[model samples]
Target: MLIGAEAVDTAVELNAYLARFGYGQGLSIQQLWAEMDRVWAEMGLDNRRPLGSQRIADFYAHPVWVLNGLFADTDPTSVRHRQAIAAFLKDACDDQARLRIADYGGGSGALARQIVDRLPGRSQIDLIEPFPSDFFRRRLGYRSEIRFHDVLSSDGYDVVIAQDVLEHVEQPIALAQRCIDATRQGGLVLFANCFYPCIQCHLPGTFYLRHTFRYVLASPALSYVGAVPGAAHVLIFRKHGEIDVAALVRRDRIARGVGPLLNLLGQFHSQMKTLGRRAGLSE
Candidate 1:
């Protein structure tokens, strides 16, 4: 549904509106909105009630999980968020692949709900969420399909996704391994959780990175935060345990294209930060 002239204009206005906090800087809002209008109308999208720069940009950019944990003060599924996600997924995963995806531990299936509108029509995406939203479940999987499970096992899936679900488990690595056990070989487990460095000790229970512009300004790292060092996104490939994600990232080169060249260097900063924490914790 997100195609042609309307989407282009909506995307442009969104990019410009999101840029005010500094990160979305210098993007041509007027030109972009003009380009994306057809996209906006086709998608039945509108930006209702303007939001703060940080919240507008953050929720628009990050996965819904990170947006929830980090910006607890704001609504996770804001209109701006919807528009941004629609625009972004169009660029990233607009392929004609029939994906048997699992939204493992997804609450209310909002992620799955949004995907229905954004992805190409009849993509055969199955969203498995143990806790499906009564409201959202009804809406999800119309164009696609969303299967709700009170409990779920990952078997019989092409791509298993657990966004911020891993941190809550005591044995996160074990949980990740279990997710791997569920995924069909060559299927992916898409994880987009927060990263807490080694220097930052675990405070008990589950905690995730709640990075803000102020937080980024104060800290020294510059990458999408992963799980804490002792805790990271533990993915098990069909054959191998780890995917060469960095090289994979290089293949896409989006980080390289977006900002300063040096900004790309910090993607691995969390790994190093974890090592540093391990040294100190061991000492």
Candidate 2:
């Protein structure tokens, strides 16, 4: 059984390094725990438990679908996504700590566990979620060396996994920097999400997914609609050293009306897979 973390313990555990990371105030363990309790009940979720001291949060739904989701969608079942995530973690792991991973905001640990299970070799995984209800669940196994942190104040990791957590943040660059800092000088920070820094769509403004709970410092709400992706988790990627920004650009130019058409094509392919399944053919 995992030895559950309480509010006070969370404060004591993270107090030493909290100041170093510029995490700001209103992060007392007790405060976060209470916030978790209130938020879950408000969402109408039945299960309740003390939030662990680490900065972990709720079980995420985005990456779950990518890794385990059975839904019919584009890249819904990612053999490539899992393979890519494992490759990223392996590339960032250091010899000093057997792959010191800082999974910030990895609430359910499903992705972390998935990566761990796929890797096969021994490695340590550290989860950082800041909700009380997250800590009390029986599924969160306890290990002396492997554990969770309410917040990430200390640095020195081979890989910092922040899948689907950036768009939700109030300060995207600062958030990216935090992950970069936790990473060793040459380590990597990998993340992803539905929103990008730019908007290719004709819509007047960009949008973000709505959180049922009012987040502590996440970006202030700017919309009334559901997320375009509709998944609870957004993924992020970080690297300790400078990233080659040039690679992101595509050499090919789109025709006048190709963007939406390209998107439609992606959807068409997704439906094709569903059609195949109905035909009793494996995708």
How does candidate 2 score on lDDT?
0.45
lDDT of 2 by residue, 106-136 (tens): 6556556666765655567787765423332
Any runs in candidate 2 off by more than 4 Å, and if so which?
Answer: 1-80, 91-97, 135-137, 142-145, 196-283
lDDT for each residue of candidate 1 in 1-283, tens digit (9 for 90 to 100)? 5566975775566446444323323323343333234333443433332223223233223222222322222333333443453344444444636556666666555556556666645334455544344334544445346677655575556656666565434334455445555666545455544433221111122232222211211211112223322223332223233334344334234322433333334556777899999999998
Q: What is the lDDT of residue 157 in candidate 2?
A: 81
- The parts of candidate 1 lying over 4 Å away from their true place are 1-96, 139-144, 195-283
